[model samples]
Target: MLEEEYQKRRVLPRHLRKQTEPERPFSYEIRPATLEDIPDIREIYNYYVRNSVVTFDEKAWSHKRWREKFEHLQKLGLPFLVAVAPTGQVLGYALVSPWASKSAYRYTVENSVYLGQAATGKGLGRALLEALIEASEQIGLRQLVAVISDKGAEASIALHEKLGFEEVGRMGKVGYKFDRWLGTIYLQKQLNPRKKPGILKRMLGAGASEE
Candidate 1:
């Protein structure tokens, strides 16, 4: 469907329709991402880059770029997770990134979740999201944000809202794809609120970490 059609109807076309029930029960596991998973992760991401407005990236990222991105996430101690099916295939992945560079925003993180074409509506995205939420909370993050494309993103928006995210903001015509203007929506979920620690307390703890 055209991006304009989606905007007009507020419904994903039948081809993009999500699964209402699993074809069969299959066990999957979510765990910290490994370097070995980069190729599969890149494949899934590049699919969206090429075919959908779900991402604003016009070109697929190079493998080197992906490697650097993953390494950076590792250095920040942020979580990168992969969902593996019973057959050992990667079903999907999720990760967090800095919302901004300033130290004052240290407790806030931007989240990304992607599922392989085969994995949607089977609850894999939900599983990855739940795991990410728990992991982020345990690591001291106080807020999680999702910046999602407004086109071809009904399922994504619904999923975040179901997970307690509130639509905090929207930016219209911020992107162009398929020869049409696209928009962006921001959703935020507050985890646990806490007072910022003083400098002396931060110096004595691992409180300087960004994740």
Candidate 2:
């Protein structure tokens, strides 16, 4: 019996013979962005800035710039979210900022989503953007716009279209970067209308009632 068992073990696949533990699945959580996540987010964005034409900006954003943007979004009560691995790495981020500076465009916002080089192709972008959309709806945003590069951003354009953003317009040679002229494709999504009064309106109503 012992000789037979040894022969069986010898013929078994090496991996099967070792009784190894199964690898933990790749998983992450989508959550509201915090101040601590800014550095990781900056790194992700700068990677694209340096390596691709996905963004028209030719220079990397400084930490100060990122912080300023973060604060600005917070002041506007907009959605800025992150996808974090179980190891606490920021895998990607999605955010919305006012589409235009004027009050008339308050309900409309432009959206941006970016993932780390190693974090792409794993559906993190979709999750982050979906979460951003849900959060924007919850906060009474009416529209979200995505400006994608006409070059080297087919995946981004496809992802936005898959999430219900329609092709609204396109501009050619509007941006010059990396010693070449690049264009933008504009995609817009109309969010679900708000069902309740916005915070400002609610506050005003409460004040009137108190008086």
Candidate 3:
């Protein structure tokens, strides 16, 4: 009789079997990242590095490394944003870096978004990416690219697609991590044209005029 009851429960429709209280809503605020947020951001990224193939980095980064990256992005005048809970906890971060060092690629950037383990699957990634796109556009960036690991990152691919990022290319078996081969999927999004000069262009113009 017990065996028969177990089988019956297993065959029942998912919704008809049982129900529990829905999860309470989560709240967070997105804003520009400050130096104080570096430790939390580094921790969030290192978790994936140590445990998952989402990032190809095999070693965890130190505080000094994160601080250097933060300062570099500040010098480049790029957007580095963070999501914070009302209780003042950093939940996630997103940022854009120069796509290429060439002067011709100044209008393009590569975007990265990482959320805390507890912050996943709550629509937080979507919010962070959207904010990054808007911020990049405001800074006169014309193109944004995302390089995502092809395996174990279906949700990331889907999120980028839903946000209008097109799959432009793929490179297979380029990265090896966790004792297995991994690949990358390249996604690109074109932003609206800017009406005025961006920070980089204005700075260059100032230097030229001074000379």
lDDT (10s digit) by residue, model 1, range 1-211? 9999879799768899896975667678899998888888999999999999999999898888889988877767777999998787888999988787656776788999999998888888888999999888777778899999998999999999999999999999999988999999999999863333231133223334434
For model 2, what is the error of residue 31's alpha carbon versus the real structure, in angstroms, after optimal superposition? 0.6
Candidate 3 to native Cα RMSD, angstroms: 6.9
**Candidate 1: clashing pairs of residues:** none
Model 3 spans with C-alpha error above 4 angstroms:
1-24, 202-211
lDDT tens digits, residue span 1-211, model 2:
6998989877967776768699788799999899999999999999999999999888999999999889877766778999999999999999987776545566778999999987889888888899899998887878899999999999999999999999999999999988899999999999985544264243222212332
lDDT of 1 at 164: 99
List TM-scores for all candidates, in order: 0.80, 0.84, 0.84
TM-score, ranked from best to worst? 2, 3, 1
Query: What tens digits encode model 3's per-residue C-alpha lDDT throughout 1-211?
Result: 6998989877968877678889777999999999999889999999999999989999999999999888878877889999999888999999998887666677788999999988999999999999999998888888999999999999999999999999999999999998899999999999975545455684333212322
Better-scoring candidate (lDDT), 1 or 3: 3
Model 3 weakest lDDT span, ten residues long: 202-211
Ranking by lDDT: 3, 2, 1
How many residue pairs collide in each prediction? 0, 0, 0
TM-score of 2: 0.84
